[model samples]
Target: MSTEVAAEVVVAPPANDAEEGTKQSHKLERKWAFWFDTTKPKQGAAWGSTLKKAYTFDTVEEFWCLYDQIFKPSKLTGNADFHLFKAGVEPKWEDPECANGGKWTVSGSRKTNLDGMWLETLMALIGEQFDEADDICGVVVSARQRGDKLSLWTRNATNEAVQMSIGRKWKEIIDVTDKISYSFHDDAKKDKSSRGRYSV
Candidate 1:
């Protein structure tokens, strides 16, 4: 009989000792899942199903473990992706949190920036480093043959004030060579986007 191991949906990392020889403190006990896409043929499984759980982490230690085990963005196949989202939050356009959301996009062909940018974006999201932290839903990285794409998803697209705040902060955090583009979910759903606004 061929033994098949069930995929682990999520893994949470444990806490570490403090500098004074005590347990470290965490302001936000948020649970996050780190997903990896290694399936060669993308057509076989849904994006969510193909995702193998590298780990779920609440502490800083496990996050590094998950990050270390995966193939970096620079090493991934063109069609592969690495997604880290809040537990139970699927990295899909149609997800409720993402349905009305928009993404701040950073695109480039440079490999060095691609992987680093992805890591920075993750920090911006989970660390709540951006000014509009409440508006953020999650982050996604698309490692394509043509170019790598990093996008930060927000819960609402119509809130220009919040959207712009997030976009500008994103540019400041990442080594973005050029301006980052903001795309609204509604506008994205339409056949075309109406000269979408970009924060340069």
Candidate 2:
């Protein structure tokens, strides 16, 4: 996506306003924004400069419509990343909503069914399935050469109980028994090879 197409807020027509037999678009608890970062960065490009806000949607129909097109996370290749965050939150470490946050990450390989996991995470997010929804910030799927990765970002890094609960619940949602690790954005900033502060 390009800057010219970014930040387009999409609030679907209300169910009451639809035609006599038209289907309704179910509204989500909160508006969510989609962002995309290209697979390759140009030489000397500014950090996050390649990121595009994409769009913001507050209904089920809009989410599916967009997902089938540009947002098919599994279609992303190379160093590309697809981010889905609460409407006002930027998918960047410096954003106030994410500055002190950390993420619970699950690495994915060739047989990991990345696409299925992506859809499951997206639905859980828009459906507000987490018990600690207040601490949730966003989710990201990074497609890389070594392998793909899915990470659920949270609003606080030091909140151990909340983080653990989230990690456990997410594992259940994605139906994975593999250990998922949580690491702080601050820690990641300091050490690219940083270890997880907690695991579940």
Candidate 3:
């Protein structure tokens, strides 16, 4: 039996004009699923059971609603991770859409304000700001004891041109001066110490 819960699909209500004549809702370019995972899991529990679908949202208002309800990366202690991916794509590397993909990762110390960075990354993803938007799969933030990590996952590892474009745009969006590295999912799974295929 699987413990994974189905993602909840939320449709943004039709925009309505207020007394001031302004539209009330802003729709996103795509629907996104928010996933949460904690450091602790049941002994002998399947990995999927430990990773749960938290919510799915397609509007700016809904995104804020869900974000407000979830724990911020800074508040998540130990090995916790937050993943925001396209509605149909699971965050795991094995997912068909992500199997051949890679990620561009940026790390910051505990003192860094990761919550803001994560939020900005999400906005960029939903806004389709990347030139290689089609190559994007999602974004993830991992909270660790030593330092935190922010990564943008893309759909093709072999497509260097697409992957690099996404990476460069991501760096610009996040406004980070630090160099970020890109690594294939397969390479990461094989050896954590392996060097990234590209960096910016």
Candidate 4:
């Protein structure tokens, strides 16, 4: 995942900042990286530099540190993306790990369950809630001017069994009311059925 740039940006944990009686904690299976992509013309330079280290945490404390520092989806301008992936995997569509995989995309207005779904999906990914985590590459969220989108990428789109299970687990994790569609890179490229060969 060539963390050269990622290594430099660090998000530190909060101090004993929690109220004495109300502390909460979480543990994740693997360490993950949080990336903020700003795709605006004016924020180019600043965004580039701002791609600074967010934080890496296996425990809940560090995750909170990074999450707390970032702007919520509602506050982000259109064209911004937030990516969370297991350490060592870059969040690029072309990565060897992601070349064949496609994302199960969920789209909706913010007034819907967009934010809740995004957060739960992230929690599922980082918390290892999927049986096919071995095939999962990472997750990306786009806050577009049109609508917000969240995607979960797998290692290979051709693995129908794994792909279908992953898709089902994703939908289950987010527990959304609307239909969620799974698309393979190949199918998506052809502009055809983003439908999964199988559904979870």
Candidate 5:
């Protein structure tokens, strides 16, 4: 039920007017699913068990509309997470698209532009701004105490060329010169990612 319209952005405060229907609507490359998890998860429970699929939006207007209402990461007083992944790709390591995947994590101070960087990352993702767009699985923004983390998930872990290209492109999109590191899910399972990480 998703529309495949060429992406054109014209974001503004959501208006409740009939004229809104007559205005041109901007479309994203594909639908994206917004997910969230609470700070206090049940002990010894399944991963992603608390995740709530807030909404799946395909249009720019829909994205802004939902973002205005429920996408409030800054309001969190405790640890939480906000995930924006491509439609159908749940933000998990076991999904078929993510089984052999990895993530490029950029850790920064909470005092920095966490929200701004996160928004930019979402825009770049839905806008298909990366050369290896298909390689992207999704993005996760973790609101932590020490520092906030922005991790761009990828579909392939062994492809160094592809992973490096994505890492560089993502850093460029976020306008950051600092090096970011990529860690594969498989390596993390073995608790050896510290030595296996690839930096760009």
Candidate 6:
């Protein structure tokens, strides 16, 4: 007696160039640059000197690639920071785009999901989800031993209406029930003891 065996073969259809291209490319409204800072600076170096321009991305795909390559907020050592700002805008209070601006800041303990919050904030800025999108300059996440801080920098600190709206939207997007504060760069630079100009 003889036994017969049959084999099944499965094949994938040919790749579609057009569909592949569409899936691979995503254009953002504005180009953005990523910056990194560490507490240990080069001896005698100016504050901005240690700040490094990491990468710039103008597409969704590029952003994800960079994100994957970089360390998340929770993974960073204490005193490390990550900055994401509009292209051509430095992540410094001295920058022309940020001189007159302010930031909305939210602090969380080590237990908090700082990485998730940071990613949400980055997506909101890049996606133009905020009503006052044009007023935004950048976002920053600072990792500290005690806790982590997330901040959204805006162009006009004195613009009460716009700043308030931005703060509200940011809190909502992050889905944090805790109140966040908004303070002017000038105030923050002048006195760490000064309170935020607005809170939501």
Best model number under TM-score: 2
lDDT of 6 by residue, 26-48 (tens): 68999998878765677987777
Q: Write the per-residue lDDT of candidate 4 for residues 129-156, one digit (tens) a residue.
A: 8888889988877788878888888888
- True lDDT of residue 111, candidate 4: 62
- On the 0 to 100 scale, the lDDT of residue 171 in model 1 is 86
Error of 5 at 141 (Å): 0.2
Q: Which parts of model 1 have CA positions greater than 4 angstroms off?
A: 1-28, 38-54, 192-195
How displaced is residue 187 in candidate 5, in Å? 1.4
- What lDDT tens digits, residue by residue, belong to model 2 across residues 40-105? 668898678888777778988778877865676656657888899999999999999899999999
For candidate 4, what is the total of clashing residue pairs?
2
Better of 2 and 5 by lDDT: 2
Q: lDDT tens digits, residues 1-200, model 5?
A: 00111011123334543466777777788899887775466899888787766677788878877666656556444477878999999998878999999999987544667777788898898889999999998998887777778899999889999999999888988878888899889888787553437898
TM-score of each: 0.77, 0.88, 0.84, 0.75, 0.85, 0.85
Q: Which has the better lDDT: candidate 4, or candidate 6? A: 6
Candidate 5 deviant stretches above 4 angstroms: 1-19, 192-196
lDDT of each: 0.68, 0.83, 0.78, 0.69, 0.77, 0.80
Candidate closer to the true structure by lDDT (higher is better), 4 or 5: 5
State the RMSD for candidate 4: 5.7
Model 1 over residues 89-135: C-alpha lDDT tens digits?
77777888788887888875435677778778776666768776766
Ranking by lDDT: 2, 6, 3, 5, 4, 1
Q: In angstroms, how far off is 163's CA in candidate 2? A: 0.1
